[model samples]
Target: MSGLRPASAGRGESGRYEAFDHLATMVAVLRAADGCCLFVNAAFEAALGLPRRALLRRGRLFDWFVDASALVTNYQAVVANQYSTVRLEALLRRPTAPHAEPLPVHVIVTQVDHGETILLELVEIEQQARQDRETRTLDQVRVTKELIRNLAHEIKNPLGGIRGAAQLLEMDLADATLTEYTQVIIHEADRLQALVDRLLAPHRRPHMVADVNIHEVLERVRSLVLAEFSRGLTIVRDYDASLPEFRGDREQLIQAVLNITHNAALALAERRQAGDARIVLRTRAARQVTIGRQRYRLALELHIEDNGPGVPPEIRDRIFFPLVSGREGGSGLGLTLAQDFIQQHQGLIECESEPGRTLFKIQIPLP
Candidate 1:
């Protein structure tokens, strides 16, 4: 926190720094002159359960809240250089949620060092602490994705040369004895190439958009999984018949669900031997769900639950990382790819695991 400056305060209007992106307190920087939001932290997103893009569309801070006349009054006063701070209580309305109640909050409006930039802080009287922590983890996930994308590119570049060298060596080897060595080299190289391919698959593939039926995707994965472990596992379906269609890439979604289900099946290996392995594919619709910053009126919730020896706590925090797998001989790219695909659709994926039960939840908004 040392030697860091506020984006709205010290810098000129040309470019603002995002100094508060990781904060636990809900804070949004708005242009006091026009009352337009310039920046918002993760806590703000959690507190309001609204997307930044949606907020930007609204064009004003007070427009999305209930009884926000005080906010407007404070904004005008701050922009006019009449007040440095203002505090009040207000009811925050969540219009997207069906039959939602007004959220009670303590609102504080303060002027930054820069003129006309008011920082609106909201303290949700009910669930401030929990919401702050969860949303802050989400913010870290976003940052982690950027780092993963850059690092994956770096790791993939040399794979081609290594594979090619192994191929050329195999071709040039004349003696059968030496050919076996080259064959081993070629085999290992190809394996690495395949692994690298999975790592790069999400970023390399083009996003194809179409009206996606999530049930169809699930059914496909279920069939494939059943066919592979035909006798050992029980895959159950618990889908909502009323789920509407949403726009997404069908193939990508299929692959994402498949990876998750397949991972569950593998984890249930010991349980399968016990003759009681079960994996349930449950689907429901959440009326008001927020993912990354977007609040959806309705989002499909897909739960892939398995009764296996749960994910080890040591690797739970890093399960989605590019190469962090729990099972032996696992590539560890499954969850990473699933996460990438979900994020592409303005969605989110979360997991909860304990002994004898592991649930992987996928939430994708219906457009």
Candidate 2:
């Protein structure tokens, strides 16, 4: 309350001052009753690329926002009703920046009465990073799943027919050389059948939603990785033990996590140095995350970080697409399937890779 002061008046005239600061991704501020800037934090300045003096002269906070009218209306309501806190999101525009994009911000406004004027605090939503990732992952999964279903159905019938014809040809063949050709046809058909089976596996199965302890799944993946690469690679765990159980298909989640972790292990396997091949599993809890444009109360964040050489830069953007692989012999379906499973649980999977570091982050909402 004491921090509220008119912009025309100096800071010393504001009397005994109290500052409220919250750590958030973007800029934030506490404003006076007249909508003058009282306290503007460093994040706000950095995000807008503006100095505190410029912000102070800007007068009402709404003036800088892209849709200032709506914000002003909400603020006025708070003032009239003595509302203690209100949350909203809006597009913000810089005064003279033409090349900058309109930034989406989640704002939290609070009314405080320290003395003669009302005070309001603003918090920008940086948590949107996770939300954006969740949205893109969901979209990718949906499209990939549909493609797999269609492709599998199209190839499966023809593959069976070809295999049956090859077997019949083998039975009718008199020459041994002719039978060898039939065997080759049968072998290739079998390989195609196997690929189709993998493509349809997720849909053919049913999902069993149960309260699952994520740590247990991570532990199982860890054990499996160690057993496969016991000699050289290392699997590290950075778990938050207090994480609550979330409703999910246990086996599906396990497989989804395994696919990602296994791919990392394989990437590490090709590295020359033994100790340099390291995979770290980290987990945390996040709040107010949006997936598929729908907001959720809480979500679990899982990160699989590796120290091996990162994904190739060329195909990085399309890695989640069907049949995209960085490895020579890889089937490229592992991540696609993993993404599908996670999307079924209303979650997402995202990756960021650079030389010597690659991070795959999975976020699933918790009930």
Q: State which candidate has the highest lDDT.
A: 1
Model 2 pairs whose backbones collide: 1-114, 27-44
lDDT of each prediction vs. the true structure? Answer: 0.78, 0.76
lDDT tens digits by residue: candidate 1, 16-124 = 6355655445677777667877777655665567776675677776877767777787778867878777788888777567378888888877777567467787877
Clashes of 2: 2
Q: Report the CA-based lDDT of candidate 1 relative to the real structure.
A: 0.78
Q: Tens-digit lDDT track for model 2 on 1-367?
A: 3344444535542222313222334434444456666556545665677876787677767777777777777777676666655678888785558578877777766565543344444444545665565566667777777877998899999988999999988888788788888889999999988888888988889989899999999999999988988867878889999899988899999999999999998888766255568889999997655667866667899999998889999989778887899998999999988888998898888899999999998889988
Measured by TM-score, how close is model 1 to the native structure? 0.62
Candidate 2: minimum summed lDDT over ten consecutive residues — where? 13-22
Cα error, candidate 2, residue 291 (Å): 1.4
lDDT (0-100) at residue 50 of candidate 2? 84
Angstrom error at residue 67, model 2: 20
